[model samples]
Target: MTSRSHSLRDAIEEQIAVGELRPGQHLDETELATRFGVSRTPIREALIQLASMGLVVIRPRRGAVVAEIAPQQLVEMFEVMAELEAMCGRLAARRMFTEEHAQLQAAHDACREAREAVDSDEYYYRNEAFHEQIYAGSHNAFLAEQARNLHRRLRPYRRLQLRVRDRVATSFSEHQEIVDAIVAGDGERTAALLRDHIMIQGQRFADLIASLAHLSNKAA
Candidate 1:
């Protein structure tokens, strides 16, 4: 991707992730081009890229809009994400090198700082870094690529999950447990923790939905 298209993609994705661009919300090519000070060509390219990433939809006659995932689809996506994360954790626990472990530790420390400051956005980015480190530590390049692709697709929903009451602190604690298990080379324990960490079922799912609704209301 060209630098302009890449930046435009990032900007649009950020808006969607933060709920500024609601699901099914229309994305006017000309408006976005004007807003971003770029030509319609780059905007169209960015929308096409986002569509491939499952973050946007391109209809034959209606143009592009943010992707609207159904609740069932959301559950299914999270289910798959949980398993992928578990697989990564398992491999990472066994295959992680000394330097990778050190990097994971540092990322964990940053998460702790974000939690201490009660900074959900900071925690969100650090949390992403922490998980990406685990994916990299897995040492299976193909598996890591698949896992990262799914991670990107679920980025918005996962980020919204952090907005649930007290979830940031709870997530940080879980990260601590995961870090300890990985450092001890306990593959099974790390895998189990990772699965639980990403799977938002029952009350957790309800809570995530509620948080998203609250954010949507505010955005409106």
Candidate 2:
């Protein structure tokens, strides 16, 4: 893809992740092109990319619109994601090198700073980096790739979850435990922590649904 297309994809993806672009909202290529000062080609390309990532849907005649995932489907996806992350953490605990552990600590520290600043966007970015370190540290190329693909697919929902009250702070605290487990080379503990960290359940699941409903109402 051209630089323009790549930038356009990122821009659209961010908007969707941040809830500025609501699920099921139409993505008019011409409007996007005008808004971004680009041609329809790039906008089309961007939407196509988003579709492949499960963030958008291209209808037969309705053109492109943001993808609408059912609540149960979302839950199912998270369940699978939690398992994938747990496996990564388990392997990472046993296989990560000394330098990799240092890098993970650095990422965790960055997340701490973002949490202290109470900047959800910054924390979200750092949080992604922190998890990515574990994925890479797993030393399983295929598993890492699978985790990454699912991570990308769920990016929007994950970002939205941080908007819930006190979630960012709680998430950082959980990360502390996760980091401690991994650094201690406790594979089972790391796996359990990672699974719980990635799973959306109970109040968090309720909050996510509420947030999605609010966004849907606004779109309506």
Candidate 3:
């Protein structure tokens, strides 16, 4: 992808993160083209990139819209995330201890810095890196790639959640828990904890999305 395409993709993703874009809403090519001071060609390419990331859907004649994440789909994503994290933990249990454990530790420390700075986006980014270590630690490149993609698609929603009161402390504690499990080579604890971690995301998505809709109606 060209720099232009990547910039456009990041723009949309940022819009989603800040709730400037909503689900089930079409992205007008002309509008985006005008906003970005680009032609329709790059706008089309950008939408395709977003589509590949599962952040939007471009249908024949129907046009492109921000993807509507259904409750069922969130649950399914959690299920897949759990399985992926479990695979990482199970493999890391056998194949990891020194190198990978250090990587996870470094990420946790970075998260700690972000926590101290009270930077929500940075914390979210570091949290992802902390998990990425475990996925890569599993020594399974394919699994790591898949988990990273899913995690990317979920980034915007996760950022919104980090603003919840005391969320940074909560997440910090969870990271420490996972690091401890990995250090101990306890696959059961790692897997179960990771599974619960992802399930909480699904539940939070459902609750927050519902509340957001209600607030929109009340304000209108």
lDDT of each: 0.92, 0.93, 0.80
Give the per-residue lDDT digits (tens) of candidate 1, residues 1-220. 8889989999999898777788879999999999999899999999999999999999998899999888889999999999999999999999999989999999999999999999988899999999999999999998899899899888889988998889999999999999999999999999999999999899999988887788768767
- Provide the clash count, candidate 1: 0
**TM-score of every model versus the real structure:** 0.97, 0.95, 0.84
Ranked candidates, highest TM-score first: 1, 2, 3
Provide the lowest-lDDT 10-residue window in model 3: 211-220
Q: CA shift at 45, candidate 2, in angstroms?
A: 1.8
> Model 3, 30-83: lDDT tens per residue?
999999899888888889999999998999997999887776676677678778
Of 2 and 3, the candidate ahead on TM-score is 2
Model 2: per-residue lDDT, tens digit, 104-163?
Answer: 999999999999999998999999999999999999999999999899888889998998
Best by the TM-score measure: 1
Candidate 3 lands at a TM-score of 0.84
List the pairs of residues colliding in candidate 2. none
Task: Name the weakest run of 10 consecutive residues (lDDT summed) in model 1.
Answer: 211-220
Model 3 scores what on Cα lDDT? 0.80
